[model samples]
Target: MLAKTPFIPDKPILIVCGHFGSGKTCVSVALALALKKSGKNVTLVDLDIVNPYFRAADAAELMKANGINCINPEFANTNVDIPSLGAEIHSVFVNAERDPDSVTILDVGGDSGAAALGRYRQMIERAGYNMLFVASKYRPLTDTASAALENLREIEYYSRLRCTHVVNNSNIGDETTQTYVENALDFGRELSELSGLPEAFTSVVKADFCPALAEKYPDKSFFFIDNTTRKLF
Candidate 1:
């Protein structure tokens, strides 16, 4: 069984944004599962219109199996037709805001996909949602932080909501170890301080050793999920 962490907010609409391959889909799915396990009604919205790979909608079946609601465009026919896609997904933000007990997680596209944020700016601003940007120092040069912040500024200009936190999701595949997790956390803290953003909202780590790891790093708060964990304030 996966250990449940209480770091998730009860009923806020959370927008998870990151560069391509920054683990946005993985983190969004894990967060939905964790929040559901903790008895919150969680819904995941796939706004990744730019990327065809690693889409949150691709995992709709898995999410539905876990009793979580997934909202995305539907493929009704064998030959994909743009006209066949339904419009229900476009209204997610409006619907989510009406239900105070439900938490909606929006997994938006990244980098070039920053334009998608513009399309939903009105809905997001009206809903008063919170945004989180996922960052991985291991995948790119340290300058990735600056680039991500720039992209986020573009997103904020369109989405009308400032990104309030960053999630450091550094990892080295299965080779990830406790030390690697610690170093990532340290890097994230430094980056957060340098950027004048709040301390990295959380550092996501693999789950196999996180409980013990969390105990050891008590000064740094954490939230554990299946195969991954995060520290959030």
Candidate 2:
């Protein structure tokens, strides 16, 4: 096993959003778990009111077992598709903003799903947030840099918030390879140039290959995904 590199959120409110099938929930789940493992007070909020398949609430039980506070929509994990958010989210944000040691991660849904974030624009703007825009080159419509940038714009427009960083989460699930990830490096570089956003990091699922990729590109940061949310499928 490779010695893991920790990914700590600089801002207390860290928002994770991206296009459909970009693995936002997976990244959020992995990140929340990582922060909690590092002894930080972590709260993971499932802000996904769009896609029902890979919701972060799918891992709510796991996160609670790991001592991470979790909040999900009322109809989450059910057959309903309501965009209902509880009043507790406001309290969580208020507390997180005041507590320096606390970190709240929002696993937002895709383009259309980001509309749920618009309601909390004032709260997020007041507390300051670091939004990570995830893009996958392997995904259907977002395979190209131009396509990905367009999707980012839609997400930003819907959320009424801008992305602070870009994360290349390109992978073909368990079939992801070193070569495929290398291709995404080029895609990420182009996307960064186009969007004018600094890269937060790239995510790789295979622990064995992650070390080699990290060594190959010392300038870029890499986070090894532990494949937690895949069980939702």
Candidate 3:
């Protein structure tokens, strides 16, 4: 296990946004799990109404089993349309912001889900959440940094919040090797510079490589993903 970083109060809201198939949910889950291990009162909120198949809510039960709070409109009231902003989410946002121990990880939807966030602009802005846009260099349409930045900007405008960081989560399924991870890191660094944002807070590495790579790249930030859980460094 790796040591956890202190959670900043103003950074309570963590918006995970990205284009479709960019692995936003995976990144968000990894982040939430890592924070929970560090003893933070983490809340993983699934706000991705657009893509129903690859939703963060799909792993809600597992997340809750590990003591992390998983909040999703569907979980509270399945009848309510996932795309519609309801009282359940609003209340969660309010309470999460007031509770100092709360670290809300919002797994926002893809481009189509942008409209849903428009309804909660005030809450998001007031929460002072740190937005992280995931950019996968291996993804077909998003291979170019310029296109990825544009997509991120669209999400930012729709969500009414500026993205503070970029996370490079590039991979090719089980075949993802160390070289692929390094390529993502290098691409992310260049993208950050191009977008005038700070360096990527971290890069995601498969769990299989954690044991060996963790010790090798002790200085660089990393997020680990496995069959059962996700963790951070």
lDDT of 3: 0.71
Per-residue CA lDDT of candidate 3, range 22-104, in tens? 77887777778778887778888878777745567768787978898877755333544446544666765776667877788
Residue 62 lDDT (model 3): 76
Off by over 4 Å in 1: 75-86, 141-148, 157-160, 199-205, 225-233
Residue pairs with colliding backbones in model 2 are: none
Query: For model 2, how does the per-residue alpha-carbon lDDT over 1-233 read when each residue is reduced to its tens digit?
Result: 32243466787899999997898988888888888878789999999988876688888788988999999999987887877899889977787767888888999988888999999998888877899999999998999999999999999999999999899999998999999999889999999999999888899878879878878999988898766666634
In lDDT terms, how accurate is model 2?
A: 0.87
Pairs in clash, predicted candidate 3: none
Candidate 1: residue 28 lDDT (0-100): 84
Please give, for residues 1-233, the per-residue lDDT of candidate 1 as tens digits.
54564356633678888776777777788788877888878888877766654467767787999999988746422245342234665556666767776778888777656556666677767776767777776776433566656655766665556777777777665677777777777666765765676643454556677777678877776654333322132
TM-score of each: 0.82, 0.94, 0.85
Q: What is the C-alpha lDDT of each candidate?
A: 0.67, 0.87, 0.71
lDDT of 1 at 207: 67
